[model samples]
Target chain A: MPTTTRQWLLNGHPRGRGIEIDNDFRLVEAELPDPGQGEMLLKTHYLGFDPAQKGWMENIADYVAPMNIGDVMRGSGIAEVVASNGGRFAVGDMVFGTTGWTEYLVTDGKELTRVETELSPTAVLSVLGTTGLTAYCGLFKVGKPVAGDTVLVSGAAGATGSIVGQLAKIAGCRVVGIAGGKDKCDWLVREAGYDAAIDYKAGGVKEQIRELCPRGVDVIYDNVGGKILNDMLACIATGARVVICGGISRYETGSLPAGPENYFNLVFRRGTMAGFIVLDWASEFPGIRKRLEGFVKGGSLKYQEDIQHGFENAPQTLQRLFTGQNRGKQMLKL
Target chain B: MPTTTRQWLLNGHPRGRGIEIDNDFRLVEAELPDPGQGEMLLKTHYLGFDPAQKGWMENIADYVAPMNIGDVMRGSGIAEVVASNGGRFAVGDMVFGTTGWTEYLVTDGKELTRVETELSPTAVLSVLGTTGLTAYCGLFKVGKPVAGDTVLVSGAAGATGSIVGQLAKIAGCRVVGIAGGKDKCDWLVREAGYDAAIDYKAGGVKEQIRELCPRGVDVIYDNVGGKILNDMLACIATGARVVICGGISRYETGSLPAGPENYFNLVFRRGTMAGFIVLDWASEFPGIRKRLEGFVKGGSLKYQEDIQHGFENAPQTLQRLFTGQNRGKQMLKL
Candidate 1:
C-alpha cells in the first residue's frame, strides 16, 4: 500500500470571475491517512468534475458551504477502501462519496455509499448517480413534462442536461437540445435520440427555437442560464414549466449585465420558472436509482462520459468543463 | 337621454415610452348609438383606470388586442342600461362591462354583468370587479401564503397590491408593503392593516426589506418589476414563491438596461417565480367573488378609491396609475 498521498487544496479564492489554476489551487504531498474508530481509509479511483465546483471555490455560501482557503477542494469521486477500522465499509469494497480532489482520504463512513458492483463506476457516477437523479427529479417535479410536450434543454451535452433530454423523451415528449458546436449538437440528435438540436455557437438560437417549436416550448430544462434563458422565455407555450438545473454560463462570470429580459412573458404565458438543488430530493433518490437503472437495462436511456486520466490533471479537467472542451460527463480517472 | 356622447379616441400609439395626453388621445363628440336586436345601449356611470390599460395602448399585443389608432380607449366601467331590444338587460338596470372611455356604449349584453344593488357602484369596480378577482386569485393561487410566512408586496398602495396585502394578512401571513411615499406607507399599516410598510421613495428598498424580513421574505407579490424586484430576489427565503402581478416600473421605460440581476438565487433558495393573467382564472372568479365579499362583509378587508370627475379627464386619470399620484384604485365618474 502507498505510504504517501497526493492532494489538491484550495490555495486562494478567485477574487474575480475566472479562476486561475496555480493561483487558486495548490498540489501537495501528505502522509497516507490512518483510519480512526468507525473510520476507513479510501483511495480515490476516479474523481468527478462539475461546473458547480466553480461556485464552491467562491467566497459565498450556496446550497453547500463555501470552501475556505487551505481546505481540500471538496468534490465527489469513486474510491476503493484500502484500510478499515470497525466501520460500515471493508477493505477492497468500492464506494462513492465526497472523496474530493485527493488520491487518499479517511472518513467515518457517514458520507459514503457503497457502490453496486453490477454497473461500471462511470455508469454509477453518470446515469445511476446524482446526475441521473437531478435530471429525472428536475424534469418530473419541476418541468412536469407531459406526453407530446415540446421539451427544450440548454447545455444538452453536459452531464445532467444530456440525461434530462433522454428522460423527457422517455416521458413521450419531443426533445430539443441546445448545445455548443456542431459536434455536440450532431451527437445529441444522432447518438442521444434528440428530436432536434440547435448549435448555439452559430448564433440565431432565438430564431431556431421559434422555427422548430412553432407551438412554443411546453417545458424548458435550463442548465445554461442568461441570454439563452432570456431567449427561451420569449418562446414558451402557455403554462410552460421552466426547470433551472444549473447556470453554467454565468458560473465563471461573477456578475452579468442582466438576467432574463423577457421574464415578463411568464405572466403573458401564465408560466412557472422554478429552481431546486438535487440534495433536496435525497429522500426519494433510492426510488430514482431503481427507475434509472430500469431505463438503462431496457436499452432506453444512453449516457456518455469523457474520462481524463491522472490525479495531476484534476485542475485542468475542471477547467475543460468551463471552456466546453470536455465532452459528456467530465471525469478524471486517477 | 343625451343625443351627443363624448368619447376619447386613441389618436396615436406612443412611439416612445411616455404617453402624451394630447398627442396620443383626442376627445370628440359622437352621436349616441341605438340598440339593435339582442343589443342594449348603456350609459357610462364610472370608468376604471388600470396600469394594464397602458399595455393595451401599446402597439404590441398582450392579454388583449392593442387599441387601434382611431378606436375608443378600451376600459372597464359601471354602466346603466338605458334601452334594450330583446336583450338580457332591462331599462334602469345597473351593469358592469367594458364601457371604454365613452359616455354611451351599444353592447350585446354578453360583455355585461348585472351589479349587486346592495353594494356601492364604486365598490363594484374596486372590491368586487376584475380588480378584486385579480387580488384574491393572485394572492391565494400564485403567492400561496402559509401562516407565519413573510409576504412582501410591491406597489402596495395601488389597487391590486393593496388588496393582495390585505388578503395575505387574512391568510395569516406577516404582511409588509412597499409603497412610494410616507402617506401611502402610513395608510398601508394604519388603514390597510399591513404588519409594516416600506417607503420606497426613501430609497434603500433592499436594505429596508432585509431589515423588515431578517429571516428573508417567504412570498413576494411584485407589481413593480425591475430594480425593486431585483432587490427582493436577494432577500428571498429558501423555498420562496415570487408572484408577478404587474411590471409598472418598466411600463414607461420601454426598454430597460437590464432585468433582475440576482435571479439565480432562485436555485440556491429553491424558489419558484410565476406569473399569470387574472382572466385565465375566469372559470373560478365566481368562487373568488364570494370569498372576497365574505372578507369585506366580515370587516377583514378594506379598500380605498381615488375617484376623479369628468369623462374628459379619462386620459389624465389613466396617467395617475403610472405617476403614483392616485391614492388607491384610480377611477373616473362621468
Candidate 2:
C-alpha cells in the first residue's frame, strides 16, 4: 500500500474570545483509501484562505453551514487528481472545489470543476473562482452602474474590491476606493485604475468622500459594513444604489456592529440599499466566467495573490484578513 | 371692488414651542385682484390635510421649503378659476395646485392642473393625487410583486397601505396586513381584501406573520418603521424585497429609526431591502392615474375618508394621525 498523510481538525468554536492559533486546532493521521465508484482521490496543492473561513470558525450563522468541532477546517482548494474512477477526469488532471484544509481529499468527480492549464491554478482559486464571481454579480446585477456614475468601493484593495474597481472602470464608471493603509491606497490608485483612494485609518471618511465625489456617489459596493457604510449613506446622491456584499468590519466584534444611523437618507434621496449572496446567481456563472477570463487574458484585469508557504500556515493566514494584513487574495501553497 | 375673506400674514415667524394655531393666523378683508396677462384668480373649495404639512411647518431643511411662520400655510387645494387671462382655462373652471388655505387666490395658471369633474374633485386629491401615486409607484416599481407572491403591508389601514393591499391582491398576490387595532385589522380583511391581518398593538408580530405566511413573505411594504420593520425582516423568504415607503414611527423620534438588527438576513436568504420615494416615478403618473381611476370607478377599490369638519380643526385633526385616532385618508373640509 502507498503511504498517505492525514488531515488536522479545528477543535472548538471561537465565539466571544478572539481566535488563538495555538489552542484552536489539532493534527491527526488516518489510513489512505481507494477511489470509490465515480469518485476521485485528490492531492491538495493550493488552499484558499478567506475571511469567511473565520466566520465558519465562529458560532454566528452566516450564509452557509458553520464549521463543527473536530471537523477538518472548511475551505476551497486547488488539487491534482491522483486516482480516478470517472470518465470526466484522469490521473494528473487539475481541479478545484471545497476540499477543506488537508493534504489529500476524496470527493465525487462531479464536485470538482476541471481547470485548463492556460490559466494559473492559483488564479482559478482566487480571481476566477467564487470571489471574482461574487464581485461580478453584486456590482452588475444589484449595483447597476451606469456610464459616468461615481462608484465607491469599501475594502478597495482586498480580493473582491480590487477586481470590482477594475470592472467598474471597464464599465465606464469613475471609481473611488476605501482601503486601510497608505500602501493599499497607493496600489488601488496606481495599479487598479481607481480615480481616487481614501485611507480609512486616517479618518475623515465622510469629508474625504464628499470632497472626492462632489456630485455624490451613484453606486457604493460595500464590503466592510458598520461605520464605513454609515458614512457612505450620507454621501450617496439622488437615486443611488448600495450593494452589501460582505461585512468584514464586524466579523470579530463581540456584538453586532451598530447599523447606519442615517438610513433615512434613503428615503429623501430616493436611493436603494440591498444585500446579496453570490450563490443566488449561480445560473449565470458560465457567461460571467467567460467574460472575467477574457478580461484576465487581455490584461484589462489584474489578479494579485498573497501566497503563504505551507499548509500549517492556513490558520495564521486567515487571521491576516481580519487584521487587513494581506494585500490581495490570500492563498496557501502546499 | 368685491370683498374676499383671506388668511394672510400677521408677522414673519412663530413664537415659542408647538404649532401656534390660534393667535398665529388672522382673517382679513381684501379686494380680489385682477388676473395678469397669463394668470388666473382662484376660489378655494377643499384642501389636503397631510402629516407632511406638519413637516413643512417645522423650521428644518428638507426636500421642499418649510412654510414661513406668518405666511398662509402651504397646502394642496381644489379651486375654481373665477377669472382667467390665458388659453388654459376660462372663468369658473376648476383647478388644483399648491394653493394656500384661503377662500380666494390668484396664480399664473402654469402650475394648476385642470380637474376633470368626470372624476370627483375629492378623487383628484385622494386616489388620483400624490397619496395614490405613492402607493402605485412603490408597489409596482419597487416591490415588484408577482402572481401568488405573499405581500405583508404595515399600516395596512392607512391612506397608502389600504390602497397598496388592494392593489397587491389585484395583482394576484396573497396579502397580509398589519394595523394598530382589531377594528382596523377587520377593515383591512373585509374591505381591502387582505388574506390575513395582524394587530401590531396586540403583539406577537413575528409569530403572527409566520403563521399567516407559511411559505414566507415575498414582499413587505413597510410604512411604520421601528420594531415592526425589524420583526418583518425575520419572516422574509429567499429573494424577498422590503420596500421602505415611510417610517412614521421614527418621524416623531427626531432621529433615524434603529435599522433592523437582523439585516444580515438579507444575505442569508438572498433578499433585498430598498428605500424609495414616489417622485422618482412622476413621469408614470398619467398611466397609473388611469388604471387607479378604473378601480375606483368600478368599486373594486374603496377609499374611506377621515374628514375633519373645518380648516380651523387642521392642527387638532393632525394629532389624530399620531395617536391612531383617525381611520383612513385624513382630510380637512373647507
Candidate 3:
C-alpha cells in the first residue's frame, strides 16, 4: 500500500442531472497516520456503492444528512484491520461498515461488523452485507408475504430485488419481476426463479402486471419508483404491502416524478406501504447474515457484482445505478 | 307502526357529479317486513350518510361491493328493534349497523351492534358508533401516535376527524387540524381541543402545516385526499404514519384526483402510510366504543351531528360529505 492514502471528497452538491466524477467529487491524497491507543488502521478492500449515495450527495431533504463539501464522500465498504491497539479487532480481521470512498481509514471499533464465516468476503459484501439484510427485512418484516401470495419486485434483476424474489419464492409465493430490458427480464425468471418477468420498457406495465398476477399483487417490493410504482399500486390486491427500499430510477436523475397516482387503492384494498433503511435492523444483523450465509453455502442464492476496479472510479461507477447500466451490486474493488 | 315503509333504491349507477336523489335513486314504498324465528324488525330512526356511499352506489372497484341498481341503497343507520322473534335482540333496544337507507329492516340478529349506553341514539351514531370507532382504531391501531408526537388530521372538524383530533390530543401529542372554513377551524381548536387548525379553503395549506408543525408531523389522520394529503406527505417527520380512512374530497366527485404526489417522502423519512376501513376492526369495536364512551362521559369528547330532518332528505344530506358542508357526522333523522 502507498504511504499516502487516496480518498474522494464531496466537492459540490449534486443537482439535477449531473453526478459525474469531475463535476461533483474531488479525489484527495493524504499521508497515512499511525493508529493511536484503542484505535486501528483499516484498509479498504471492497467499496459498496448504493443508489442512496446519490441522495446523500445532494442538497435535498433525505433520509440522511447531505455530505458536506470537502468531506469524504460517504459510503459503505468491506475492509481489513491493518494495525490495532488492544481491542476487539486484530490485524487482518475483515470487517464491513460505512468506511466511505477511501483507500484507508482509522477507527475505534465503531460501526464495524466482522466478516465472519468461511464464505468469500466479496460475496459477503455483495449478497450478505447491506444488500442481503435489506432484502430480508424489507420483504418479511414489512411486505410480510405468505404462502401462495403473489409478490411483485421492481428492479428485479438488481442486487436487493434479486434476493427478494428468491426469498419470496422460498416462502412459497408466486414471484413476478419488472425489469427495464429483455435480458434482465430473462435473468429474473431463468436465474432468480421469478415466476414471470415483465419488461417495463415495452410499456403497458399495468396491463402486463394485471394479466400476470390475475388476482393483483399481494406485496410490491418497489426499488425503482416513479411510473412503475403507480402501475403496481393500481393492480395491488386487498391487504397488499409495498416495501419501499430504494427509488433508483429517479433518485437523483432530475426531478422526482409524482407519487403513485393509484396509491388510494391502498385505502380501498386495506393495504400498507412502508419505507425502511437497513441501519434500523442492526440488532438482527447477525441472524440475517447467518441466514444469508446458509443460502449461499447451500447454493440457493445467486449473487453478482458489477466490480469497478480502483477507488478512483467510485464516483463514475455510482452514476450507473441511476442510468440502468448496473447489472447487480455495483462495487469498487481496491 | 306504518303498514308500508319507504326505502331509497339505487336506480342508476352514480357517475361524475350526479349524486342528486332524483338522478340516481327512486323512493319505493314496500309492505313492512315481518320478523321470523331468530329475527327482528329494525325501525331506522337515523340514516347515516357518508361520502363512501357514492363509491357504494357506483359500478367501481371499491372497499365494498357497489350497490346494484334497483337494490335498496346500502347505508348504516341508528335503529330500534321494534319486534323480535327471539335470540339476541329484544324490543325497544337501540342498535346501529348496516341497516340501509330504509324506514325498516328485518334481520336475523347478525350484524347489529347494541347501543346500550344512556347517550342519545344521535350521539351514538356520531361518536359511539362506527364513526368514533373508525377514529379510535385508525389512529391508535394503525397511526400508532406516540406521546409528544405531532399529529396532523385532515378534515379535523368532521365526525371521524373530530374524534381523531381529541383522541390524539388525549394521547399527549400536539394536534394540528386542517379544515375548510374558519368556523370549522375555530371549532377544531375550541371544541375538538386541537392545538392548531389550518383553514384549507383560505389556501396555503402546505405553508400553514409547515408553520404549525415546524418539527414535522408525526402522524397524519387523513379524511380528505388529493392536495392536502400531498402537502402532509411532503412534511411528515421520520417514522410518521399516515392513516387513510376516507377520501371525502374525491370519493363521490367525478374521478379520484391523482394520489398524493408527495408520497415519496415516506421513503425519505422511513415512514409508513396505511389505509384501513372500520369494518376490519369489528372484533375490537367493544373496546373502542367503551374508551370513546369514557371520553364522552368525562366531557373530553365533544361531538356534533349535522342532522337533516326527514327520510326524504337522505340523498341530499349524503352530498354534504363530498361538499364539506357537513360540520360533523352527517345523519338524516326520520
Candidate 4:
C-alpha cells in the first residue's frame, strides 16, 4: 500500500580506508513499485551488517557482485512479504535474502528464503541466520577441531566469533578468543564459554597467546586479519588448521593489508591455511541451520545481536563493525 | 687408509645473513675413529648442497637438529663404506645419508640408504635423493595438480623446481616456471619441459606470471619465498593449492622474512596453502623414487647437476644455492 520507500544508495567508491557517510552513500526517497506475477514486495524489518560488505563496495567482484555508484547498497536482511503476487511467498510471511539497504523491495521470490516466524527477529537475523551458518561451517568444515584441541579465534567478541567459540567449546576443544577490549574479552570468557580471552587492546597479544596456549594453537578461526592473523600464525602447532573466515582488519583498507609474516611457519609446522565463503555452501545451509538450532535448544550455543533503530542509520551501523563499536551481530531495525 | 680426516666445524652462528667460511666455520684435522659394533666407517664421495642445509645451520632446530658450534657442518652426501661392524652393510658398499662436511663418518647405518650403483652420483643425489622426493610428494600430494591445471613453480631451474615442473607436465598440467634469469628460464622451457618460463630477474615478475597464467595458477610449488611468493598469491585461481616446499629466500636472514602480502586473496579465491618437509615422507620415499625413476628412464624427466670440485670449495658451493649462481642441483665432489 505504500507509494514511496527509502533507500541508502552507494554514492561513491570509498576514496580511502574509512567509509564516509556523506561521500560514500546517499539517502534517497524512491517510488515503490508493485509486484508483478511471480514476484513479491518485501518490507525489510532488519538489515544485517558484515565485514564482507566493505569488500562488496570495492570495484572488484568477490563471491558476490561489487556495489556500484547509484545502486542500492548490497546487503542481507530479515524482511516480511507485505505484498505478494508470487506462489512461493504470502503476505505477512517472513523471509531472508539479499534485501539490500532499503525499506522495501520487489523481488521475483527466487533469491528469498522463507524464515521461521516462531523465532524472534534477533534470532532469525543472528543465531539461526547466515551468521550462525558461517560459524558452523567454518568451524566444523575448515577449522576441523578435534576434542581437546586448542582452538584460537580472532574477533572473539563479535557475532560470528561468539558463536564459533561456543560451538568449538561444544565440540570439546579448549577455546581462546582475541577481542579488542576488556569488556569484550570479559564477555567472551564469561558469556561465550571461552576457556580464555586475550585483550588485544592491552597489547602483548603474541605473549598472551603464548602464555595461554603454550603448546600452540591447533585450530585457528580468524575473522580479524592484519597483525592478529600474523600473531596466530607465529604460534600454531604442528599440523594446525587455520580457517580464514574473514579479514575484518583489511576490509576497509584501500589495498589488501600485509599478510601473516609467519605464514612460512606452515612449512615448518606442516600446517594448512584455507579460506572459504559461506555462500559457497548454500546448498547445505538447511542442514547447517538445523544442527545449529539443536545446539541453541540444548543451551550449548549462544548468540547476541547489537541492533540500532531507523533506516537512515544503516550506513553508520555498518561503520560500527569496522570500528569495533558494535558488540555482537550488528543489525539495524527499519 | 689415512689416519687423519678433515672436518669443517661450525665456528659460530652467523651474526647476520650470508654464510662466511672464515667467520662461521673452522677446518680441523682429527683422528679417524674406527667403526664400533653395529657401526660402519664411510669415506665421503659426493657432497650434496641444499637450500635446507642453510636452515640446519640456524640457531633454532627445524626438522633436523640445529648445527651446534662444535658440530661438523651437517650435509647429505654419497659415500662408500670402507669399514663396517654393522650387519646391514659390508666394505666397498655405496650408500647415501647425512655424511656432513667431513671426509669420513662412523655410523650405525640407520641414517644411511643404499643407492643403485648403475646411476651416477648426481642422479642419486639430485634426482633420487631427498630433493626428488620433495618434488614428488609436494607436487602430487600437496599441490594436487589435476589434468589441465595451471602449475606454476618458483625456483623452477633449481634441482627440486626442475623436477617439479617436469613432474607437473607429466601429470598433464600446463607448467609455467619462474626462475632467476633468461638462461635459467630458457633451460626450464627447453630442457625441463615447462610450457613457459618467466625470468624473474627481468623484473615485472607479477606481470609475466599474469600474462602466462591468464586463467590463474592452480598449483604453485614454491621453493623460493619472499616477494615472488607474494606475486603468485595475487593471481591464484579459485580452489588453487599452494605447496610450500621451501623458503630459500629467508634461510639466511637474521629473522624470518616477510610473508606473502596478498595471502588474503586466498579467501577470495577459496584456495589452500600448505607447507611440508620431505623427511616426513621418508616411509614412502621408495615408492616415490620408483615413480620418479620411471619418468627419468622413460626419457620424460630430465635433470641437471652443477658440480664443483675440491673439498675446500664445499662452503663456496653451498653459497651457489643462495646467489643464484649454481645452474641446477649444486654439488661438490670431495
TM-score of each: 0.97, 0.91, 0.92, 0.98
What's the true lDDT of residue B10 in model 2? 34
Rank list by TM-score: 4, 1, 3, 2
Model 1, stretches more than 4 Å misplaced? Answer: A1-3, B1-4
DockQ per model, Cα: 0.68, 0.50, 0.60, 0.79
Give candidate 3 misplaced runs (Cα > 4 Å).
A34-43, A80-94, A105-109, B1-3, B16-18, B30-43, B80-95, B104-110, B113-115
Using TM-score as the yardstick, the better of models 2 and 4 is: 4
Question: Alpha-carbon error at A120 in model 2, in Å?
Answer: 3.0
Worst 10 residues of 4 chain B by lDDT: B115-124
lDDT of 4 at A169: 93
lDDT of 3 by residue, A177-212 (tens): 999899999999888889999999999999999999
Ranking of predictions according to lDDT: 1, 4, 3, 2
Worst 10 residues of 2 chain B by lDDT: B10-19
lDDT tens digits by residue: candidate 2, A250-322? 6767345557766667777778888787877877876888899899898889979999988777778878888
In model 1, which residue pairs have backbone atoms overlapping below 3 Å?
A: none
Error of 3 at B181 (Å): 1.9
Residue B167 in candidate 4 has what lDDT? 93
Candidate 3: true interface contacts recovered: 0.69
Task: For model 4 chain A, give the 10-residue run with minimal summed lDDT.
Answer: A116-125
lDDT (10s digit) by residue, model 4, range B38-108: 88888999999888777777766465676789899988898898888864888988888888999988888
